[model samples]
Structures are given as C-alpha cells and as structure tokens.
Target: MRGSFRIEGHAIASEDGMIAAANGLMPDSLKFPSDQKLYEQALDQAAVIANGRLSYEGQLNSPRRKRLVLTRSVSGLAPDPKNPNARLWNPAGESLEAACAALGVTGGEIAVVGGPFVFSLFLGIGYDAFHLSHAPGVRLPGGVPVFHEQGSGRSPEDVLAAAGLKPGPVQRLDDGVTMVEWTRAA
Candidate 1:
C-alpha cells in the first residue's frame, strides 16, 4: 500500500483526512513524485482492491486494464454477468474472506491501495508484504494516519512488527523518497 509519510507519520494530505478536498482535488504541495512506469507495471495482471472512485477512473484506464480486477464495496453492486474483471463487495453482508473467494482471487500477489480503514482491515488479516514509502521533507500535520489505529502512540513500523512482519532493506526512490518492504516473518 502507498502512503505519504511525514516526519510525524501523518498520512493524508491534510487534517481533513481527505485525499482530495471538497473539490475532489489534491494540492500540488501534497503530491509526491513517483515512478509512473513502476506503478503501471505493478497494476498489470494484479487484482486491485480500491474504492469506487478509483476503480472506475484510474485503474480501469490503464493499458493493462484487461488483466486487472476491480473490486469495490457498493451495495447491490456486482460484476457484470459478461465481465469477469469487476467485483462488488458488501462488507456488511459478506466476509472479506468470502469476497476474496468469490472474486476467484487466490494464490498470487494482491495489491491493497487504500484509505486508512482498508489498511486497518487487512492488518487484522495479515499481509505477506508491505511497501512503506517515506517522503522526506513533507509533512501533513494533523492529517490522517496511514494505519487508522496508529497514533495511540505506536509508529507504523511498530504496528507492522506487532503484526509479525519483518522489515526488509530500504530502497530509495526519486525525489527524496524511500521505501522499505516488510514481509511476514517466518
């Protein structure tokens, strides 16, 4: 999951915890530079669990769009009878386990791009790996925390460790950003 890290570990672009403000737009100051190619390549052939907004616009527009599965939680929503690429998940009506099974999402890398709630949901289930990116020199003071349960005084890394993931080497990305991968400890 990709999150913006500030010195204080805040996640959202602002205190409102809105990725995009009332206008549905993020300010330039909050936008961190990223490798577009890497992001595109990762989405190829991957099952993407994203919110309704992103499912329709962002991921669906990719060139590897055909290989991607769009899963969202919307009441009364379902994959088109003829289309195997979309899945509608009702968290209130179904278990995450059941949703995954119904989507036929089994035995491969599952990318979880999220808001804090989604990240917290998966934390309980467990993650085989987590790629945490830190953008130095940027701070979203009073912004949302990447892990909703965080700021009870525990750092995100501490939360991951508590969940049994072991940190891997740090990989530096462009623009003063760095990422560290954490794998479930054997």
Candidate 2:
C-alpha cells in the first residue's frame, strides 16, 4: 500500500505520544469559509504524520484511523490498546527514513505534518503536500513564527519540488495560510 506522506519530528512526549495540528491550534470554527476549508482538509486527511506528543494518548486522542507516533524510545500507545489496528511506538533512528526503515513504512507517501523541526528537516528531502494556514498576513508582534524556522533558502514549494514531489493544486486559505498539495511523480 502507498505509505503516504512522510512527516517526522521529535518532541519528548510520552513514549507513544503525538500531536495533531487541530489540537495545537485555536478553534478552527472561528475561521472564515476559505480558511475553514483548509482546516477541513487537514481534519479530513485520513492519515496524519504527527510529532510524538503526550496529547495523542488521550482517550479522546484515539485516532480515527492509523496514526503513528515515531520516537526513539520503546514506549507505545493504544487508544483502546485492545484494538489491534490502533498502535503507537518509539523507533530507533536519527532520521525519518531510518525510522521508516525500522517500521517497514515506505515513507514516500507521507505529508510531513510538522510541529516545526520536522517540516524543516523534510522540506527538500521529498516533501510533497504542504498545508500552511496562517491568519492571512496576520502577525503577532511577539508571537512565534509559524514554520519550524523561516527558510533562509528556497521557497518551500521550490525545495520540495527539487526533492521530487509533483506539484499539484495550490489552494489559498482566506486566513493567512495556504494549502499546497504535492504528489510524488509516477
């Protein structure tokens, strides 16, 4: 099966911990229609590659589908623990590819959902789909910059394209963020 977009990040949550974009953000219900569409896209992305964070272990955090939390430790997660499909783990690897190797995941189809560092790490290594939603040019004077680190290099799209992702449609969110979807070329 297509492993889907590869997103890898590190955070010292529980061994099986992970966090999703929706949880990290303010209510998406407050956003405008276009922006909401983007939010909905994120919510609808059946599989999300997230940073291992404690938030993912919530009884409520039980993923609707398969959600993986990649860590270097031996910790594990199970929303029900009883359900065989629901899983969590900490793999040994310094990079996503290495972890994917251990997990048997192909790693090409992943979207690279990031908390910061992961996005930066995978940007050029074959990053495909980028869903960035900001409050349309809205900036908090003292607020943190959204991306892991502002790229002093190529535009995200450029870097990823150079890495081998096929450019797809780019959708603008009424809020500051835009959804850039990319696919690996066949």
Candidate 3:
C-alpha cells in the first residue's frame, strides 16, 4: 500500500531546537487561533502518526480517538490490543515500514504532527507536503526550534529545500500568521 505523508508545524521557529517549552509544553503565546481548525481538518480523513510524547500529552490522548499511531523507543508499551484504530510502535525493535504494515494503513495521507524528533525522522524519509504556519512578530527565545538542524544554523526552509521540497504560494491565516505549503520537487 502506497501512503502519502505530510507534516504540520505551527507558530514561529524558536531559537532553541525545541518544539515545545523547556517544560515540554506548547505555550500560549506561540499558538494561533486557527491552528485547531487546521489540525481538525488534517485529521479529518487521515491516519495520524505522532511522537509518543505528543500522543500522550496532546489531544490524541482522548479515549475516544481512533486511527492514531504513536511511535516510541521504549519497550513494554504497546497499543491497546482491542483497539484496532490505535497502535504503539517501538522504532528501535521494529521498522517504520513494519509498523505501517501492522497498522494496516494504506493509500491515504498520514499527518506527522510532531515534536522536533518526529519531524526530523520524517525529514529523512521525505514528505509529500509540509504545511508550515508561522505566527508573525512572535519569537520563542528559549523555546524549541521547528527543525532539528535549526540550532546548527540551518533554517527550516534550507532543510526543506535540501530535502527536495519546493515552496508554494503563501496564504494568510488569522492574527498575522502566514501559512506556506512545501511540496516535494518533481
């Protein structure tokens, strides 16, 4: 089964290489009002692959949620055997390819909404598109950077470009935020 992958990153890129605050939580200042709607739309008809931390701390933790896969490096933690829509993956023991197979996910978009590590992982695997929303005039001084290499002096755009993604036209969102779509180069 051929699956398409896309990543969504919200808010301004931080100076530090972190997706959340030092406390591992997303702060209010960086959040945009429209992010919730965008996230809902992305998750509407697609399966979601998210980092373990995010899965637990974010909205994916809702007991009623379905079609969600959480990837973690730790052992002894597996997806509920009874829930076909939820899956737990140990990347160290199993390959992402294998995990996808077990999840029975095929032929639909997989939204990789992440922390930096998750984003970094998919960056190497490649993406069909990346939806990046930046909140203007906001900067996270000690907050995490959107890309892993951002701390190394490489911008997120540079990283995407290096991965063969081409930027599309910019679209405006609420509160001075701008969203850009980056698609893989043909």
Best prediction by TM-score: 3
- The alpha-carbon lDDT assigned to residue 95 of candidate 2 equals 46
lDDT string, candidate 1, 76-115, tens digits: 3466443465556655555554555565654345555555
Q: State, as a TM-score between 0 and 1, how close model 1 is to the true structure.
A: 0.67
* Residue 12 alpha-carbon offset, candidate 3, angstroms: 6.2
- Segments in model 1 whose C-alpha atoms lie over 4 Å from true places: 1-27, 30-36, 50-84, 101-104
What are the lDDT scores of the predictions, listed in order?
A: 0.51, 0.41, 0.61
| TM-score list, all predictions | 0.67, 0.48, 0.78
When sorted by lDDT, best at the front, the candidate numbers are 3, 1, 2
lDDT for each residue of candidate 3 in 68-95, tens digit (9 for 90 to 100)? 4444544523665656656676555665
* Candidate 3 off by > 4 Å: 1-18, 55-77, 80-84
Q: After superposition, how far is residue 85 of candidate 3 from its true place, in Å?
A: 3.6
Residues forming the 10-long window of minimal summed lDDT in candidate 1: 1-10
Between prediction 2 and prediction 3, the one with superior TM-score is 3
RMSD of each: 7.0, 8.2, 3.6
Residue pairs in collision within model 3: 18-144, 18-145
